[model samples]
Target: MGSSEFQSPRVIKAAGLPYFTPANNGGAALNPEDPSTPTLFRPLTIRDVTLKNRIMVAPMCTYSTNPDPSSPAIGALNDFHIAHLGHLASKGVGLVIIEATAVQPNGRISPNDSGLWQEGTDSEQFKGLQRVVNFIHSQGAKAGIQLGHAGRKASAVAPWLSWEGKKGSIRADESVGGWPSNVVGPAGGEEQKWAPGNVKYWAPRELSTSEVEEIVQAFARSAKLAVQAGVDVIEIHGAHGYLVHQFLSPVTNHRTDKYGGSFKNRIRIVQEITATIRAVIPDGTPLFLRISATEWLEGNPVAEKTGSWTMDSSTELAKLLPEFGVDFLDVSSGGNHRDQKVEPHGNYQIDLAGQLRKVIQQAGQKTLVGAVGLITEAEAAGQIVQGADEAVATEELLAGQEPKADAVLLARQFLREPEWVLTAARKLNVPISLPVQFARGLL
Candidate 1:
C-alpha cells in the first residue's frame, strides 16, 4: 500500500467528542455543543487491525435461546442475538467483543453459554455466529470473541434470574432463587457450591503438564476458529476466577508441582498459551488477555495476603506479555476467590488500570491497556486513559452510566437490550445510525 492510496481522516478539523485522544494527528478543536472533542472517539489500531473508537463492548453473557431456555444453547442465529448485537454496531462502537463462549462442553460456565464445543466446522451454530460477525463488520465494527473455561465457576443460572453465587454458598437447586435447573459445577452428584464452584474447589486430577499443554493447544485452535468465523480480535479469559484465574491465584491452584506453588509456575501456562495463540493467529490481528489483576482474596492461602497477581503483578504481566504480542490488558479485578474483597463503586478498577499502565510504560513496553468495572460517565472512563483511548465495560456501564467504556463489553445488558446503544445515543444526544429494523420505535 502506498501513502497516496491511504484513506482520508474519518473526522474533520472539528472537535472530536469524548476525551480519549487519537494516536496520530492533532485532535480536532473542541465544540461545546457537541462535546465531541478529538479525543475519546479517535481511531486505534492494535497490531494490524484498526478500531474506530477506544470504546469496546466487553464480553458479556447472554443466555438466550429459541425452543427452550433450559437446554444447552446450540449457538443459533435467533432474532434476539441479532437485535442485541445489531443495535450496538449501528450505534457505532469501534469494536465489539463477543461474550465468553466455552471451548469445551465441560468447560462451560453453564449449559446455556454459547460454545463451539461441537465438531462441526461449518455447522448452524457456527454459521449463526458468523452471521453476527458479518453484521458487526457490515456496520464497520470489528468483531472479537473471548475464549474461556468456567472451571469451578462452571454451571449456574443465567444472571437474569435471581441467582446469587459466592464462596461457600451453593444453592441446592434453582427452586428457591438457586441457579437454573441445568446449571451444574465441577462437583456433581451433590449440592454445587453457589458462591464459587461448590465442594473443595480442589485440583481435579489437576491438569497434568500434558493436559495443560492440550489446553494451550485448545486456546490456539479456538483463536484460529474465531478468525475463521470472521472475528477481528481474540481474547483469552484469565479473569473472574475462571480457568486462567484459578492458575493465577494460590487458593484455587494448590498443586505442589511445577504447575503450582510458585507465581512463575502459575503464570507459566498463560505465558505459553498466549504465545501459542499468537503463533497460530495471523500476525497483526489484535489479541487481548483479560486478567484478575489482583486476587483481592483476603486469605488466599496460595498467594497468601501478600503475593503476586497483585496490581503490581498485573503490570508485570502486561509488560511481559508484549513479547508474545499482546495488544492490550483488559485489567479487571477479583474472581480468584468466591469472597474477593470487592470495593464496589463506579470506576473502582480505574486505579488498578492506571497503575498497571504506568508499570508497563516504565518497563519500556508499548502495549496498550484497557480498564473495566464500574465506569459510569463516558468522560471519566476516558479520563483514566489520560485521554489516550481504549476502555472496556463490565456489567454496570451497560445498565447505567454515560457511554463510558471505550468498548462497552456487556453481558446481561447486551442480552436484555442489544440495541441499548440506540438508547445510549438518544439519551446522550450523540448522533448515530441505528438499523432500519429498529428505527420505527426510536424514530
Candidate 2:
C-alpha cells in the first residue's frame, strides 16, 4: 500500500483512460499516484457517515434462528451468524447489510427468520443485533440491517430444509417444526402457491386498514431500535415481492382503500414508513430503500396481462423518496409475481438503476443510486463504482444513459467468497487494507 505501487505512468495512463477522479475527493491528478484512492477504493459519504469504500455486502437471508412463541422469533445471533458475517466484514468490505429481518412476528418469511419486533433495550433480539453491529465496526466495515415483512410469502421452511426434501412438503407444520400460526398480505384473494421441489406455499390472510397501520408503526419502531443498536445504515426491504412491494404493485394490491389504488395511494404506506423512521433516527444514519424497480410482468407479452409495477413507476417513486428522507435507492427487480419474466444475465438490473439515477439527477435531488446483479468481475465492479465501462460495444450501447451506479452491492459473490473484495483489489491492481492476521496468507 505505497504510492510507488501506482506511480508508474503506464498504470496511471491505463487507469485514467476509463475513470476520472471526482471533484469532491480531489481534482483529477495522476502525477503522484495514490494507491489507496482507486475509483473502487474511494470512500463514499452518505448523510453524516462515510464508508471506507463502495463495496457493500448485500443482505442475503440465512434461515437460521430459534423463534419465540409469543413474539417474532428471537433471532439471537449465535456463533454461526457471528462467524458468517464477522468473517466477511474482516475481509475489507466497506459495508455489510444484514439479512431481511422482520419488523413484526407475522412478517417473517420463515419461522426462523431474524426479527427486531420485540420491545425493551435489553431484549435478546436487541442485544444480539448490537453484538453484530459492534463486531462489524471492529472489523473496519459499517453495519446495516434490512427491515422487511414477508407478507403473503411467510411460514415456509428454509431453502436448505426444502432442498433436502426432508418431509416432501413445503408447509412447516407444528408437529415437524415451529411454524408460525398465520401469514397475512395486502388483499384477500386465492392464495398464490408455489413449491419448488418439495416446498409448500401457504396463502395469507388479507390485512385490514388498521392492521396495515399497525405494521407501518412496527417498521418505524424497528428503525428506532436499529439506530439504538448502532447500525450505520437502515435499508427498507421493499423489494422481492415482500409486504411493501405487495402494496406497491397493482397486480397484487386489489384494495380500494387509501393504501391502494392510484400511484400515490399505493406508495402511501412506504412513504409514511420512511417519513416516520426519518423523524426518529439521527440525521447521520443513511436510509436506503430496496425496490424491485419492476414487476417484470407489465411489458412482457407472454407474461400475465396485469397492470403491474413498472420501471416508470419505480422512477416516479424514486423521485419522491428523497423528499421522504431516503438517501439511497438500491435498485433490483422481478420478485413480485411467479409469472414475471427476467433475463438472467450479468448486470441485468443495472439498466433499471441507471434509469432511476437519471431521473433523480434530473429532478435535482442528491439521492444516490446503487445497483446489484451479476456484477462478479473485478473490471465490472470497478466500472460500476467509477461510472465508466471499458468494453467498447457495451459502452457505446450505454452512451446516453446516466453514469453507472454510485455503489454496487454484491450478494452471491460475497457468499461464495467472503474475501472477494480483496481478490478484486488485487485483480484491479489497487492496494487495499488486509487484516494483519491474514497478511501471511495473502503473501
Candidate 3:
C-alpha cells in the first residue's frame, strides 16, 4: 500500500500543546487556486453529507444501565442518552455514531442498550437520540446510528455486572427439553426456549428461515424509526458475532440452505437487510456497515475458512454493497470467534483494510472504505490514506487518544472526553478551533 507519502506538516505549539501546521495533506486541507500549490483543507463530502473535518466519534455503549424505568434510573433514558450523545456534539466531530441500538426487544445485547424496535421506542426511549442529532447538527456534525442484533451472543451479562444473570441465560438443544428458539415466526413450536451458550457468550437457538425474515423486517422497521428520529446516516452492525455476524460465519451458520452453504449465501441476510434498510432511509443519506472481517477462535460460529467475509470478502462486499446504495465500509475483525489470530500492534488489521481497498480499487469499484483498529499516530494514519494502492476510498483510524486515523473514530476516548474533537483541533492547531464558550472550561 506504499506509494504516495504525505508532506509532514511542521508541528507548532498552540494553547500549550503541540499543533500541526495545516498542510496540503493535513487533516483539513483546501485545494489551492494555483497549480503550484497543493490542495489543503478540502471539505470531505460523502453522498449528500459534507463534513467540516474528517474526524468522527465512534459508537460506544457507556453501559449506563437504563434498562428499567421502574428502577432507580427508570425515567433517565432520555436524559442519559442525550447527555452522552450531546457531549460528542459539543466536541465538534464531523460524524458522531450513536451507540449500537437494537431493532427488537429480543435482539438487544442487554436490556440496557438503546433501541428503535417499536413505534414508541424512539418517541419515548430515544427522544434523547433526536435531541442529540439536533445538537450535532447545530455543531455541524452529522449523526449516525449503528443498528445491531446480537444473535447467538444475545441475552448475556454486561461486563460491569456479575457474570451470572437469569435474564440472558439461554438453553441448548441437548440440555433438558431441547432449545426453544424464540424468533418472530412460529416454526420451532416444539421447543419454545432461548439459545444456549457454552461459554460466556450466548448461543442462540438456530433461527428458521421464516424467523430470519422476521429479523430482517425488524431491521427495516428500525431503519424507518431512525429516519423518523432524524439520523443523517445508518450503519448496520454485521460484526463482532452479532445476529448478522452469526449468519455470516461458517461456524455459527451450519444451515443447508441458500443463506448458508457459500460465502455469498451466508452473507445474504446481512446484504438483504442493508438493502431493505437502505430502501427506506432518505435517499442520499449515506449507508455504512461495520463487519468483523474474521472471527478469532476455533469451533466459533463466526470463523471463516477462505471465501467468507475475509479481506477478499470485504473487497467483494465493498464493491457490491454500493450497488444497494451503501457509501462506506467500517472494517473490524475477530468477534465471530474468541481465539483469533492477531499481531496486537498499532496497525495489525491495517493490512486487512489496505488489502481490501486494494482489491476493491483494482476492480474499479466505487465504494468508500475505512479502518478502525489501533490507529494512534497522525503520521501513520496519513501514510495509509496517501499510499493506498487502489482508489482506497477514505481511511479511518482510531486509537486511545483518537487522532491517528485518516479520520479518527473513537469509543473510549469520546466516553472519557466528549470534547475530544475540540481538544484535537486545539492540539492540532486548526483554524476552526473549539467555540470560545468552551475555551475557559477546556483546561
Best by TM-score: 2
Q: Which ten residues in a row have the lowest lDDT in candidate 2?
A: 21-30
- Segments in model 1 whose C-alpha atoms lie over 4 Å from true places: 1-36, 65-78, 159-205, 298-308, 389-443
Best of the two (1, 2) by lDDT: 2
Task: Give per-residue CA lDDT, model 3, range 1-443, as digits (tens).
Answer: 53224333232211211332121112222332222211111245677887666656778865454665244332223656656775566566667888888786666665566767656543564565666566555554678898888665555445455335534433322232122243322112222113323534333455778778877888888887776777888889988767787677665667777777787888788778977887787787888888876554543333434333455566666678767677777778876544565656777666666666666666777666676776554445445444222222233222212221234465665656665555554444444444333545754
Residue 40, candidate 3: C-alpha displacement in angstroms? 10
The sequence of per-residue lDDT tens digits that candidate 2 reaches over residues 1-443 is 97566554222321211232111211111221353345566677899888877789899999887755654336665556778987888788888899999998778777778889888789888888887777777666889999999887777767777778666436665654444346778886454443333346676677899999999999989999988988999999999998999999887787898998898999998999998899889988999999999888866653354488888889889888878899989999988787787877876798788878878878988889898999888888877756322222234235753356888899999888878888887887765655645767975
Shift in Å, residue 309, candidate 2: 0.3
Clashing residue pairs in candidate 2 (N, C-alpha, C atoms within 3 angstroms)? 67-73, 170-199, 170-200
User: What stretches of model 3 exceed 4 Å from their correct place?
Assistant: 1-42, 69-77, 120-122, 163-199, 296-309, 386-406, 426-429, 440-443
> Could you tell me how far off, in angstroms, the CA of residue 139 lies in candidate 3 after the best superposition?
2.2
Output the worst ten-in-a-row residue range by lDDT, candidate 3: 32-41
246, model 3: CA deviation in Å?
A: 1.2
Number of clashing pairs per prediction, in order: 33, 3, 18
- lDDT, candidate 3, equals 0.59
Q: What is the descending TM-score order? A: 2, 3, 1
Better of 1 and 2 by TM-score: 2
What TM-score does candidate 2 get on C-alpha atoms?
0.86
Point out the worst 10-residue segment of candidate 1 by lDDT.
Answer: 21-30
